[model samples]
Target: MINYRPKVFDEASKSHASKKLYAILLAFIVVMGIILILESIIPAIVSTKPMLEEMNENGYLENPDNFNFQESMKLAMKVSSSPSAMIPTLLSTIFGTVTAIFYCRCIEMRPVRSMGARKEGFFSHYITGIITGIILMSAITLLSVALGVNKIEICHGVNYKVIALYLLGFIVQGMSEEFIFRGYLMTTIGGAGYHTGIAVMISAVAFALAHAANPGFGVVPFINLTLFGVFAALHVVVFDNIWGICAIHSIWNFTQGNFYGISVSGSNNTESVFRTTAVSDKAFLTGGEFGIEGSIFTTLILSIGIASSIYLIYKRQQLQQKKQPSQE
Candidate 1:
């Protein structure tokens, strides 16, 4: 009896979006292209000298013959680990948000509000999401420490400036992915007459596949990422807005990388307040090179989050049903 799709889903359906698969493919091309262009141009403009210096020091220049995939990846990691380079890299994600919004709003003629860009209660929802994000991540980190899978140490000579930059960058980066995946993709599919479960599953799978190229991305990481997608999608459905998910995504990444000094989804560590290092070689426990996001702990937490969201959706549906009788 619990069945109630959000207003945004119905709104998107009324827009008559193109066939789901075709829409997803075209949007992928458009959004990825913009992100690629901005990612390349911004880094080139902002971190050109520092990147070159790092590359040369890493022997990329002196030993061109030996520069292989591993060497290339090493250089890439160095760039990502550097705050100046990472800022531009992260900031470029805004294009992903913009491209998805433009495609849905202008091309499909869908209203922006249909994508959960609502103004009412935006601040409240966002603040709540931030709190939720901090708690979830803290639980994972703390639990890991308690089990002796990881150890935390305060960073010496920490650069508050770089940490601030990362915080700003993660805010944009997190919101971009939410807008693209949850706000745009999931709703578009659901609105096109697909079952809500199908919409959520497809979007979740797509999210996991998108991260396949990252370092240390294995089966566990893929599962964890997909579960995260499911959690986020359900949260959106229950809250009936995108702002909460955006804040959650932003704070989740910020807390993981900047607050805990852990690698963010297989990326190298950046400026963090405290460094969390693995005490064991168990990939299931420490997540190996992918960081805690890939660990079994993440799987457990995301599963709980998913379950909680499902319950909320059900309760909301029940409340609506109770009101229907009075109105009649």
Candidate 2:
């Protein structure tokens, strides 16, 4: 059974955070602004050199009139694959975590633990989360391969160094997102006297919409993203801490992109351990440009996860009630 500690909400209630939707909206703006500024800094500084080199090779720089949009896009994709170019993009996500923490601690006057940064049981929770993430992502990839939705082949001469860099980046990237969405936004909303249900749903939808601009994002992908957000939120509430979900998010992305060689959320392919090549023509099964995260198998796994989380929450609630004496 899961532990249902409502410490976040209880603390939020005592704080002077904005009421209802304002907390969410304000938090959204602040977090987004901070993240955008931080994410742009390194990329803008370092990525320009690669782009210039690509442009020079393609003669786009020498002859501005002959600039080809298609070729430029390909150049961008190629540059994005370079570890030196992309690692900074991933690492910059730390600002998201910092931004959320700052807003909560300073702006809202809430303690860090109230944002689900509880120090107790962090290691065990994080390890369990890592295993759970691997299992979940592996299930999607293996099922796709077994059913002929996709095929996998060993990526020879794989750059383990590059993949390690990606792992580091994903650690920050995933934790940043969870801290912003689940820790800050969701908790803030719930702390403002709103129903936890409302807080969860709103944060989940916001998370989905945040990715609407990704390539190959469609109706089904939107649904899946929202479901993922819900699953992450439930995990947060069930465990009453962000460490597990943070690890899960990091492992999920790392396993998808670097371990199984699948595209991560419509992003371009990077160095991976195994290359998952598409064999089927069906976009629904193989997820087209969105990668395995958009596949039907993902839907199934996330649904099971959500159901399990709900069951755990219910069981925890029952256990909590039993622990309390009757109020007759």
* C-alpha local distance difference test of each model: 0.86, 0.87
Worst 10 residues of 1 by lDDT: 15-24
| lDDT by residue for model 2 (8-78), tens | 87776666666858746866776787777887798778778889988998888889888777777778777
Report clash pairs, candidate 1.
none
Candidate 2 TM-score, C-alpha based: 0.94
Name the lDDT value of residue 286 in candidate 2: 89
Q: What is the TM-score of each candidate against the true structure?
A: 0.94, 0.94
Q: RMSDs, each prediction?
A: 1.9, 2.3
Evaluated against the true structure, the overall lDDT of model 2 is 0.87
